[model samples]
Target chain A: MTPASSMNAALERQPPRLMLADPILTMTGIEKSFGDVRALRGVDVTVYPGEVLGIVGESGSGKSTLLRMMNLEDMPDRGEYHLALPGQEDLNLFTLDRFSRRMLRARHIGIVYQNPHLGLRMNNTSSGNVAERLLMAGERSFAVLRARAKESLDASEFPISRMDARPSELSGGMQQRVQLAKAIALEPALLLLDEPTTGLDVSVQALVLDTLKRLQRERRITMVIVSHDLGVIRTMADRVMVMRNGDVVEQGLADQIFQDPQHEYTQQLVHAKL
Target chain B: MKLDQLTKPWEAFSYGFLDQSAKREMRRRILKAIAIPGYQVPYASREVPIARGWGTGGLQVTLTLLKPSSVVKVIDQGADDSVNASSIRKFLRRVSSARETLDTMEADVIQSRHRIPEEKLREDQILVLQVPNPEPLRPVQPDMSEARIMHGDADYGQLWLTLYEQLVRSGRIMQGSSYPSMVNGRHVMTPSPIPRWDVPKMHMAANLTILSAGREKRIHAVPPYTRVEPLVFDDVPYRIEDHADKTCYRSGVTGFFMNELPQDDGSSSFEVSDSQYGVKHIRRQEGEPVTLGETYYREGRLER
Candidate 1:
């Protein structure tokens, strides 16, 4: 075997660390472009198990693109993407075929879109929308479907009575809760949230954020969140990555990043937020 | 390059409005559904000109099986002449040029929404029942993936408990339509929105029944002679709607499903819910020779 591969093989044989030895996700030198426009360039991010990693950037800063790549909805032009699933070795995501990638996304990764319409089926009941994901994962019994959906919705602090209401009938905050319920129904190992509280009112945003924080704590799953709002990142994320013009400028612990920003752009963002 | 090679001969539309590939896919799924009786088989339900939830499932099945010589019957709540039924019938005719019949006995394929025919369906006939919600366990198990596992394990304890609770509270099985029934002692299927009376017709029946839900993207089947037993305690015998004794005021047909028409007075008059059967009765009374097929219910009671 080659030197690097032999080292990797040796690393695989070693017993996994009991805690924080390996990250759940590792993306190295990820490069992506849309025609002539470069969306992401040499981006690298690693998130430990159960850690909430936040990506904060202005619009068109490649935050959404990188988030989508984690779920394999968007492919990087070049990168080494490795995801270590629970009870499994780190999988080289891009090397695996398309079907395997989809199965992985369906079973291991849960994504909450910025727009609830993109994630929630508007015509189906809120519970039904959550049930759709469970059904896709091969659930068929109505009894278990209802019970599990009720539990997830209850976890999000959504009213039990409104579980039967369609997403169109719900308030914006309630719809986001429904989307969260849908994503987490599979009990995915990785949760991705994109601007989950962007469009809601201040009070509603708090309610949604609180519910989300509770669920994350209760589930204890790895999370990667993308947002333009630094306050959201500070509230929920353990680590924050600041990006600009399709490149990450700085990344550190959430507190460290806020207290002492090194990059000029990050410093400007911090000052503006304060 | 010849003209024939450049383009095919002019035609109004494909045989079933659905292209050949779509029809082929439907045929494959239908065969699989029939083989695994009462098993909900998934399919890529294609978009039709009609809306998604409006009998599109039954329409797709009918279109797949339809031929120029096949006689088609479409019914909405037992009425062949209702706007929805006739409109579907017209659409089928426009696409496939199949013969349209109001008589259930003469139809090779019958697509129905929410009800089954009063006249007994024959062995050769195929019943395509439109299902709004195919998952019978939806009320009990809202998560479909878990529901599927329950089906695989044949775990229906919760469903039975639900019935028991209903019986304890209401003193009767209060489920009005889409009564859940066990097919072939295996899967419990929602027999579309068919009334309780029409459900027993599926048990040890001579016709093949296909239940499809377009929006839900599922198709399940019950073949001839398959056992379809409704969920019930052995002590409390299964009961249908209490319309066995009511007579149709218009057709003078007694001992069949009836639609109660309320009058300006405090009372209500009843008419046969099966519109075509009533029409046939009216015509036969006027000296038109029409043979009414044998029915599942004889003299207000279902005959085994």
Candidate 2:
């Protein structure tokens, strides 16, 4: 057999996306660099439909860089990104114009940032934050907006009494709840979380993590989460990808990676976690 | 008055009159604007006899369609004898032999500033509306090219966001004039500085409406039987000015748009905005027969 053909066969069997006929997102040969420094080098991200994929790495390891590219927020210098959503099958997101890309992101993809200030507008009421995306997607009915905002906030376990309260007026956990409520308000096909609970204290982080897990399960949403917290990756992710120095070192089922890590860096990470 | 984005600055004026070629050029642009409703068509705006921004856009249209047999009525802020309306009417008569009248039904062409005629216009009439700003995206996107691209792509999320922010801050939409409306379900056009009450009159109306901006050098049209819907949320319905309960003192007419005249002792009085309409009301009261076209509003609510 030709060497390149053999390698292609081997690579095809690697990600679980190939096992399933159609994946929600399939990215190949993604590369991004800043001047002389490479943030991501030849990264391939494959996310199956309705599966949770976790990316774990140390600081400056390009875990967040890879996650950002999934949402088209930070476009890779070169890559082919094909995504499938309901009614829109296999759209090449990388080649879309800015206007269409923005519309697609608004109507299809939902993103949650680590900082509540970045994710939720601090001045707007909690319900306003949740309703902003719906409004942008052309939902004009105030009664429907109110009901849907209440439904999302209630689903996220946010207090119904504080629906009109602003994000700055709430605690960190409650603010994260609002962020979660807004991200899922549209019921987007894909959700990307970047260090969702990193800024909170340990107790608040646990509360926020619990809320995130419940929402993810109930919605059955396909997700790609980037976190340095191994416990989060262990409890939440179905599969895990390990990265170091702008390259993915190891990836497999979450249980296998935690119990018997294949790479030395992954073994160090698994062993270092208490 | 804002010169920061003048793409084609005014180079010269030709005695404030349009030649036959200029009129033909305007006809082409008007036809294009009508063909693609609500899309702004750029044109060479000639400096008319009046000062800039003083209904020169509407005056250009009036001059273009001027004929000795044409009967023209000019109204500003719903008043026939207002300074702006009177000057434009005298100018039209002086330039051409066209007759001037304050009666809405007698006029073949009506050139207006701000408000449409209170009397429902007929299919035979054409309404020339003077526009100060043609770009509805000006508030959200300041760059002309960027605004053009937004219009081309029909990306109006920022406009909705602005309205949402305003609603969150205030109790209602504070946009009182030039209500941005969706024309032909495709392009969002500013219905020229008209009040919210007058916007619904253009939707599926029999009369043709042409909006033009001189200083901005842009023109758009809403041909007969087109949809002109104000941008509003379904649950948060569009509310017009609250003038239903008020009555006009001069003509004893109630349930029409009124202007609140303040008194010296912290009081107010109501006057009918449509001055000629009020005159007709007084003439009828005096037993002089005057035909009043069916008003667009009855009991201060638009029938359509």
Candidate 3:
């Protein structure tokens, strides 16, 4: 059988359904340090499938570091990263070899960094950027990759006809959407977004967020977004994790974290936003 | 004091003063290489105060390409710790202070001579070859201008004819050392000074093959999946040489072209008698080991 046909069959066999029976990602007693400075200290969090978990914190509060740890891009000095795979329960991402973890990230996990310009190659066309992950996953045929890339762009509300245009020609929001298209093209089980809408204007941010919400619903993708914007967290997050000095001060449903914040730090954050 | 004699030490120290400028130039060349993806560029190469056949080219490339996270490997012949290999390794350690490895499988950047490692290389890994001469046409025509003009017009007829003539004379092409092949069917490139035994292994190889001539100041690449054909004649056929057996005493690896070692007793003990015993013995003493096993023999002839 052809490779494309086999990939299609595999996609069909595992339909886009949320599996919430077990926690998709679990971080236990996580701690990180750079030289003498401690970034994260004794932090624990759990992420379930098909849920948008927002991690809100101030600058230098270790939100980005935590996200990096989750993606296995940076290993914590002391932590356990137990990630759930299909038919497997809580595999430690940190313990795996670099190649194996790379394979897992390539096939099952996708990350969108904060800088849209950095996320996608500026020299490559939009379609090229979108199709990169698919190509890396052993999809060699240009026709099939282009088709899937086009479909993803259209789904993400991007201008599909302009797929040949480079990222430098596109606006910040459009670049973010192109990155989203790239991440979603692989049909990743987990999506880790780090301030994906920070550079875009409000209108563009709303459009991008709406696209993400629609994608999460259709693909049943689990999302963990790290951002400082409380408004964004309120709009998309099912649960909120409020961090302070590398500690999760409050974590519960978004409403509870916003309306009935128990910790002083969370209260101060809400007051500052107000 | 005689002016020339007095100025000699200053001339020697001038290389140290010129190092920063040379590195900047190399960085620009490397950036151009990355920007164009597979294109090679000429850079101002310095005599690294090491042996010519050593990894001066690889060292220069690594110095230009290194980041804090890079893990480097250096191999000579094939094993990691031959005398020349250790010499380059020590130089890099002293110069770049970068991490070094003997394991081919783990290196992010590898500097190799004579043989590509038996292990598969990852896409992220970069392989740099030390090249004596970058031009494939230098052997046929001694003049640089004529060779350059021939390369410009993609004229490889002379090379093909030479191979055909060798085949007619010997029933097989018997040339070795710095074998010539076409890169992407566009540029005729020498696969450095590796033995002819390792020539066929570079065909459509997985890693990006970068060749640098430190003395010549030229760089080139054979991109992944690009055709690398050794010029051959149809009647006699292009045949590759291999050891009768794959055995390396030091590395204990199989399926590798090996160097044969002489026993300490000096009794002419046969380590599987085959063609080119002297060359193999010299290579073995130089720390290249034969791959363990019986030599792969076909009808009484051992294919190199």
lDDT of 2 by residue, B43-136 (tens): 9998787899899888998888778899999999899988889999998887777899999889989999998888999999999999999999
Please give the lDDT score for candidate 1.
Answer: 0.85
* Per-residue accuracy of model 3 over B153-253 as CA lDDT, tens digit each: 56665565445334434546677767777666676777887776666656766667777878778777766656777665333345555653445454333
Quote model 3's iRMS: 18.7
lDDT of 1 at B302: 91
After superposing candidate 3 on the true structure, give the runs of residues whose Cα lies further than 4 Å from its correct spot.
A1-20, A87-90, B1-212, B215-304
Ranking by TM-score: 2, 1, 3
Model 2, docking class: medium
| Fnat per model, in the order shown | 0.00, 0.57, 0.00
Q: Between 1 and 3, whose DockQ is larger? A: 1
Which structure among the candidates has the greatest DockQ? 2
lDDT of candidate 2? 0.84
Cα displacement (angstroms), candidate 3, residue B122, comes to 32
Which model, 1 or 3, shows the larger lDDT? 1
